[model samples]
Target chain A: MKKVKIYVTLRESVLDPQGSAVMGALHTMGYNEVADVRIGKYLELQVDDSERALDVIVKEMCEKLLTNTVIEDYRYDVEEAVSK
Target chain B: MKKVKIYVTLRESVLDPQGSAVMGALHTMGYNEVADVRIGKYLELQVDDSERALDVIVKEMCEKLLTNTVIEDYRYDVEEAVSK
Candidate 1:
């Protein structure tokens, strides 16, 4: 099996309220050295080995549903899943 | 400055409904090759140089807020933030 790890984040130009909230919380907790925070989504997929390439399948999945192309950017890492 | 990338995921035994829902959707969309789906949280933090080590600060943040250590696992990657 193959494991695909995807990371999706809001575009830099967009405001991230959740991130800001966390940053504020950190500051309040006395971690004043924090400069910024951005929160995003991480997804892991286990897929059966297919005749087609895994990258192609993953990219298609990301473009179709994993990310909103207009406002978010996504990147992925794929690795061989270890046998149990 | 330092950039820290954090990945947080539910422990292996935990049930992930959102992940299952996404897997179901992918199957319905004809991506039958997908076997399992797991979703998690990704966080990016930009931190200023501090008297304490970045790892210490990051671990404190993760343990206190970034992760729910009871049922979740977290790992992080740190790098120097590029100057604009």
Candidate 2:
């Protein structure tokens, strides 16, 4: 089995109000050492097989469905595992 | 300075066509042992200061702008580093 990990984040130009809030909280909580915080998402996937064609297929999926390429970006890690 | 790492990924129930494609590649690449692969996004943030109230601000930013909560989920890690 193959296990894949994907991460998504916003473009730098965009303002991150949410992160600002967290930074504010950390300061008030006495965790003043912390400077800023931004939140993203984690996606883990399991695939049936490994092949060169899969890369194209995956990229297409990301562009077409999985991600909003306009505002966010994506990356992934691949690993091998045995099926249960 | 504080650095925040955010991860964005799809829920397990969602179909990962992109991951399947990567798995196919590994198999064709002579790495037949590989089973699956999934892709996601990463977001790193640098905050101006660390404060207790920052947490709330950050969360709101993520909710309002950074991520698409419908199909994606997010999490973050916080650490302090000396500012240059």
Candidate 3:
């Protein structure tokens, strides 16, 4: 089995309203030290069978669905693990 | 100004229940190809002042609050930008 992680964020040039809301919430909670904030999403994926051809298949999936390559920057690594 | 990002995941030795639910949700949403999934929290923080000492102050914030450091693995970067 293999695992993939995807991190998604608005393009650097885009504004992040969600992040701002979070920062505001934190401030109201007494964490007034916080300033401009940007929010992003994190996702993890597990693959069923990579028996022999893992690299190619995973990369294709990442390109086609796991990520919006144009705006998100992601780093993924595959590690062998005992069956879940 | 500077920004901080914190990524928190269940320690490798612990089981992630929320993540499992999300995986199930995805499967039901027609992403049957998805398998074991893990979920984590992402946080973004903005700083107010760092007139001359940015690194030192930022590290203190990250260690004392922005992250739980005990159970989370975080990577943060600071870049200069026009004040917001």
Best by DockQ: 1
DockQ, cand. 2: 0.29
Model 3 clash pairs are A35-B46
Best-to-worst order by TM-score is 1, 3, 2
lDDT of each: 0.94, 0.62, 0.63
Model 1 misplaced regions, further than 4 Å = none
Across residues A1-84, which tens digit of lDDT does each residue of candidate 3 receive? 566665656677777787777666667655565666766666667766634466665566556665577876555666655564
**Per-model TM-score versus the true fold:** 0.98, 0.53, 0.54
In Å, residue B78's CA in model 2 sits off its true spot by: 8.8
Q: lDDT of candidate 2 vs native?
A: 0.62
DockQ-based CAPRI category assigned to the predicted complex of candidate 3: acceptable
For every candidate in turn, the CA RMSD to the true structure comes to: 0.8, 7.9, 5.5
Clash pairs (backbone) in predicted model 1: none
Rank order (by DockQ, best first)? 1, 3, 2
Off by over 4 Å in 3: A48-53, A82-84, B1-3, B8-34, B48-84
lDDT tens per residue, model 1, B1-84: 999999999999999999999999999988999999999999999999989988999999999988999889999999999978
TM-score of 2: 0.53
- Candidate closer to the true structure by lDDT (higher is better), 2 or 3: 3
